[model samples]
Target: MADPQSSQLPEDELTVPRAPLNKMIKELLPNVRVANDARELILNCCTEFIQLVSSEANDICNKQAKKTISPEHALQALDSLGFGDYLQECKSVLEECKTVAAKKRKASTRLENLGIPEEELLRQQQELFEKARQEQAAIEQQEWLQLQAAQAAQAQQQGLHLQPGMQPTAATGGHFQPYQVAEGIPQHGAVPSLNQPSSGAGQLPTESASNQQIPPS
Candidate 1:
């Protein structure tokens, strides 16, 4: 027979569940149970392994861990491991963890920086293409203007059979070879026609002018 006094419960009371830390440690670690900082380290390792298995944190695991283990309790384990102001060794471990974490964060940031963002990279590429098109247009315009100038100069030269010295010399294209005309040829800025007989056609032979002609298409 059960003890009546101990077994009695109020009508509205609910059953309470019990947990023992030592039993929990033994169960969690399998064969390697210890009631000390070693146990805390084992627990930390188990947490890390679980997180690894998660690959990423899951809602269910997070809820469970959050409900079962308070941040204060987790930290107290660290505090026992000689971390922080409580122990000098603890301070070293804390600093080491901080350094490692900082390095990881820096590496992550570098990877992000090296990556090309979709929108911004495309915008920059578009801007570069536009600028190149503008430059090409300007170059084409300049070439067209130069072509017009050359054609005008050639047309003027062909109009009159101007001896080189007869007319005040018009500047020629840099590649235009100057023709030699007699120094004493008729001046007055007007050229005699090529068909017209010269006053002294063959009297004193003058060096004929030569021009570098571009090949016909």
Candidate 2:
């Protein structure tokens, strides 16, 4: 029996080639007619073995620059594989399709490269901040107004007691009155110790108007 270790893939195929174009194209294109045409084109070419895989070729064919590869290169790769015979006209169509798909992918990548939609997000955040600020300002304004009203009420109370008559104060619209000593009363200030009738002592004592002694009235 062949030794398993020695019989494992020979040195040539063992390097683990990525995108093994030759084998991949064969697998990709199964059509014999396409493969035949590709082979014939290659054989008929001039001394320069120009496999049409360059970016220029891709551009000429209008491939979108998504993958590092050109679509023309991809088709050529397919044609080079045994399946070239199957995809003559179809390969061109496939390349065009790939180009369109590539353009979309590239566009998507560009959008992703920019940060996630910050403009809309910032706008929403700004709106929230402004709303909060307006609410806070409104609250502050209300508090200030309330404080002013409270101060006005306190001033009115202080002024009421400081005035001449102890009658019902205008500030309170007579709702509150000073406490009275009697039924007809003046609680404080100089209005009247005069609630009392003018008896012998009640009237103001007056001296004679002229220098001469006046007769008794």
Candidate 3:
């Protein structure tokens, strides 16, 4: 039967969930059938038991000027409430929990887990950085050379002369050679005048010719 006082407590105070309580009861008494009212009674009793222990532990904590309840305080509360027969088992469980927690903390802080010494790690990082820097420098140098070559080629194509070192190939559409005249072409100063006749053609008489040939005329 459920306790009258537990039944009178507010729903919010019943923190023990019913489903786990019902499951536990079934596991403990598989062949025996339990009523729903019995299950409700068990649920309420578990909640009341937990509340009683926690309240006593809180009081013990306050008396010791502590704001939080530790596991020791809970154990003390259980002993004070006349459950000393369970103390040894609870202490063993608490020690096991603390051992597991310490192992986890130690594993988290161990430097050996990284598989490399600090100096070796730093050396590897420096090597990677140097490799990347060298690659970047080489790329920039190649790009600069390409730009200079392009500018030189453009100048040559525009008929501007360049030094031997700066000359580009004909494949780049540039002509760097000096200008030349073709064969059989006359020089600028040796060209003949159009107003003068050829030497073998009939000629007009000059003033000297008129003074000599007048008797024959």
TM-score against native, each model: 0.24, 0.24, 0.41
Q: Is candidate 2 or candidate 3 better by lDDT?
A: 3
lDDT scores of the candidates, listed in order = 0.57, 0.58, 0.79
Off by over 4 Å in 1: 1-116, 160-217
Candidate with best lDDT: 3
What is the TM-score of candidate 1?
Answer: 0.24
Worst 10-residue lDDT window for candidate 1 reads: 11-20
Q: Tens digits of per-residue lDDT for model 3 on 154-212?
A: 87667687654355468667755543455445444567565664454586766687889
Provide the clashing-pair count of each candidate structure: 4, 10, 0
* Model 1 root-mean-square deviation: 22.0
User: What ordering of candidates by lDDT runs from best to worst?
Assistant: 3, 2, 1
Candidate 3 Cα errors over 4 Å, as ranges: 1-10, 99-217
